[model samples]
Target: MKIPILIVMLLLLTSATSKKMWKTRYFTKHVVQQQDTWCVHACMEMSFGIPQCMALHRWLEYSQQLIFPTLNCCDLITPDNYCNCVEHGGVARSEISSFLRQQFSPISGVFTDLWDFLPRGDIVQLAFLSVRYTSTYHLVVLREVEQVEDYLWDILYCDPEVGYSTRVYNPNKLEIIY
Candidate 1:
């Protein structure tokens, strides 16, 4: 009887220790609790064009899940509040602030999720769909997110015949993968 009791107590102690260890590991780490691809897809659509954003926003709103929201390019701008161009100039602090003011507007706080250069490339995938060559810069949109790490991640998209791209952002200009 004494030996059996000892074995039960040891087993219970081991189980409790393991459970506590797991709880610590899970809670202490900054793990992303949820990942909604529709959010990602809608973001990509915003990157692609204004027409698409409008259309997708309507669709998401009409759809059942209601998990994501529609975006407005004009909301990304100020004074006009409907312009689709962020790169009217380069990203300066003042420009970004103006953009943010528009973004955080009390009526509609859209574009809040828009990322600056440093944190922009969070969850995108580049499939190298096609490339465009402008007089000044080249552009590409990859297909899928290639890697995700604690610090950063990569999306595999097409660009102007260049190698892999690490995106850079500024308040004055908004660069999209598509």
Candidate 2:
């Protein structure tokens, strides 16, 4: 009887130890708010885990090529320039900000299982099919979260202007995979 009881207790202990450890996670607080069409910049920051300003500056480098081949990082983010390209793929106030808000086609937020990729500590760039809570024509980053049951996990994310939504992602509702 003692041997059986010992075995049962040890088994229970081992089962608990073997269970997967779960945790909740999210992006940095430096997420840029949706201001002056800064959704893309904010998304970039969330995706890259950098400051909003740095994301904007880096985007200046990435989009500069698309807007104008001759433009450089410094040319777009200078004190006077600030990516104020009113023409081309760019827009005023900040070229990166305006272009992100297509205001038409291309949609907002990608229809993806953001939760699927969050566990790996990956930051994915997403364009939503609809306005995700408070953002429009913006980019956002989905952070990885570890939970014992995915059903209980509300994916943590930051819109251009806000950080972390209260709502959670339901796989059943989001059937469109793309």
Model 2, 1-178: lDDT tens digits are 9999999999989765742322223344545443455555555555445544554454554565443346443345434554543122222333433444342122232344534334432333333322334433444444333343434444444445556643454443221111
> Which regions in candidate 1 have their CA more than 4 angstroms from the true location?
1-135, 160-174
- In terms of TM-score, the best-performing candidate is 2
For each predicted model, how many residue pairs clash, with residues at least 3 apart or on different chains?
Answer: 23, 13
- Per-candidate Cα lDDT values, in order, are 0.30, 0.42
Q: Compared with the true structure, what per-residue lDDT tens digits does model 1 show for residues 86-146?
A: 3222222223333323322221112222133224333222212222234333223333332
Error at 140, model 1, angstroms: 0.7
List candidate 2 segments past 4 Å from native: 3-28, 34-36, 46-54, 64-144, 163-178
lDDT of 2: 0.42
